[model samples]
Target: MAAEPVRIDDPADPRIAGFVSIRERDLTGREGLFIAEGTVVLRMLGQAQARANGFAAEAILLLESRLAGIAEVLAAFPPEVPVYIASQAVFDAIAGFNMHRGVLALGRKPSAQVGASLLGRLPGTSLVLAGCGLSNHDNVGSIFRNAAAFGADAVFLDETSCDPLYRKAIRVSVGSVLTVPFSRAMAGEAMLRGLAEAGFEIWGLSPRGQVSVAAIPPARRIALVLGTEGEGLPEHILASFRTARIPQRPGLDSLNVATASGIALYQIALAMGRVA
Candidate 1:
């Protein structure tokens, strides 16, 4: 079992600095660290840590009242990971709000994997998602959640996509961001090139797509590319790759990127027999 929880009555404690003013410091504080909030996300972090899947908990700050209910999830962490408890008042003070979920973890992101390296790791018969210029956190998170639901083997985000590790994204994903393997930081064109070179049959999603996503021709590997919500996929990308549409009703320009991703992933996954 993990060690007993340490109590931190003071909100200013340096040991818990990573948890302070969390919302305001999201992009700045804790260099490469992220806050995993709620019981579900924390449990995923614990599983990753236990499996040595590249992410680990640095410390967890819990509301004192939540201890009994959360004990089993906390036990999944190794003993070396510290667990701290604070009264509701102190927890609220440190978090800069009332953290009703009452569980938070300071997690370290894995070492960066090069985009090409991530692509190379996919299985020969893989189904993956490739995102370009997807700047919305909720969209990215929902995409990841959809990926996990549909049995996508991995996800790749281009340079302009927002970090999926962002607090809101991770939470919105219901922690699927932790479970799904992903890579980011490549230029949009380079990312597509890498996928193509890796033997993936690339299909970009668009309202004007010539083929329906479900009717996509069989391929050993598939990469479904999604773009940011409003502009949809770039014109050049559409022209360069085989593009597919969801067959939406006319006059409706398009679906939300996240929602579009789910429909596309589900249809593709069904075709590939990746999902029942």
Candidate 2:
């Protein structure tokens, strides 16, 4: 059965109530959902249907000009999922930005349990722990994409990290965030203890380090901890974990957190014999 397409010109349409971010309304308690934009992301969403089963998805919103092509893809969805169409101007106004690809979709948020169980399933090797307050969605997305491409087992975020499922993060990750298994650590001391109990050797990435990243010993299980830009890791967390540094030409300040994460993830993967 073909998915129904709904056409709307008004930005105030109630059907898209969740798409609009209202500041006055506190959404902190609301169950979080993921918004994905662009055809690339939509396609990935369709491909990941099995993993995303519990997560409900909104209809694909597209410009009328792109309706026909998008319809072919929407056919993969159940008939109950609507496909919304709007004029380019109306789409831009409703989306609050120039949606160059004229496509957006909302996916149901994964439960914390789903993320927590990931650690038990990972083949003992290396993982990337996002410890910083990565408030930037783009950076969070890029980190997940890199973690997936570099063969990292899982991506773990500290309590202060950004929402990986945010629209910007999903778009930047090209939807790879949906496929990557991740969980949030409770907080400082507990997070460290949980990792230790899990048999993961936590290695903090910082400029002031006793060992170079290249010198990290091959371990059965490893977790690479990354800090936010500018602030870096907290001194307490630094004191808690063994530290490692990336070798660079003197005078260079530091690599962007995402770039540093990619290099570190790749190196760890290689060292653990998980990747070439």
Candidate 3:
């Protein structure tokens, strides 16, 4: 069983400091720490911790009323991980918002090398998502949700891509950001080059791609590169790699980058026999 939830009536309790003003700290530049809200995400964090995926819950703050419902999830964390409970007013005060979900957690990211090491260890036959200049957290989160849905082996974000661990991004992903193995912080060109060198058949996604996504032949390792919205893929990137387009109606310019990623990843995953 998880340890009994510690009752904290004070919003300024130093132990719960991480839970204060959560909205302002969503960027989580605090040495790889992040806030996880809602039962679903807390559950995913538990799974990541259980699997030793290099993530762990440092503490959890919840409204006293939510204690019973989330007890199962709290049990997943080690007893040493503090679980703080507060009255609704105190919880709201600590979170700096209404906190309708009545749940919040402080989670620490894995080691820095976790993402960088994914490439060298992927199996010979695999499919991965390569993102370039994906500046939107919602899109990044959606891409991860899709990556997990389609069984993409991993996700690689170029230096310009937003951190998938950002608060809104993680929430938008419904915790898929924790579930999916991903690496970020490298130049666009170099990220793709590393994939190419790793034997991946890099395919860029664009509204004006050279071929239909279905036409792209199957390969042992495929890297589907998605770009930012509005501008789409960089000119240099489109020029350098094979590209695929999702056929669409005449009026619309293109699907949202996140939506497009789902369709493209589904096609590639299906072609690779990863999805039925």
Best candidate (score: lDDT): 3
Task: List, residue by residue over 1-276, the lDDT tens digit for candidate 1.
Answer: 677899998999999988999998996645779989999999999988888768999999999998999899999998888899999999999999889999999999887863346777778899999999999999999999999999998999998999999999999999998888899888888889888998999999998899898898768899999999989889989989999999878885678989999999989888888878
Model 1, residue 105: distance off in Å is: 0.3
lDDT of each: 0.90, 0.76, 0.91
Q: In model 3, which range of ten residues has the least summed lDDT?
A: 23-32
Q: Tens digit of lDDT per residue, candidate 2, span 1-276?
A: 447688988988988765554222222524666677788788777766645634556666778898777765676566777778899888877777677788877667777787767667777555656566666777898998898888677787878887887776787888888777788756755766777788999998988877889999889888888888878888988898899988887665788888988888877887887776
Q: Give candidate 2's TM-score.
A: 0.88
TM-score per prediction, in order, is 0.97, 0.88, 0.97
Query: Residue pairs in steric clash, candidate 2?
Result: none
Q: Count of backbone clashes for each model?
A: 0, 0, 0
Models ranked on TM-score: 3, 1, 2
Winner on TM-score between 2 and 3 is 3
lDDT string, candidate 3, 1-276, tens digits: 466789998899999998889887665467779888899999999999999989989998888999998788888888888889999999999998899899888999988799889999799999999999999988998999999999888999998888888888888999999988999879999999999999999999999999999887899999999999999999999999999999888665779999999999888888988888
**Deviation of model 1 at 112, angstroms:** 1.1
User: RMSD to the native, candidate 1?
Assistant: 1.2
| Candidate order, lDDT descending | 3, 1, 2
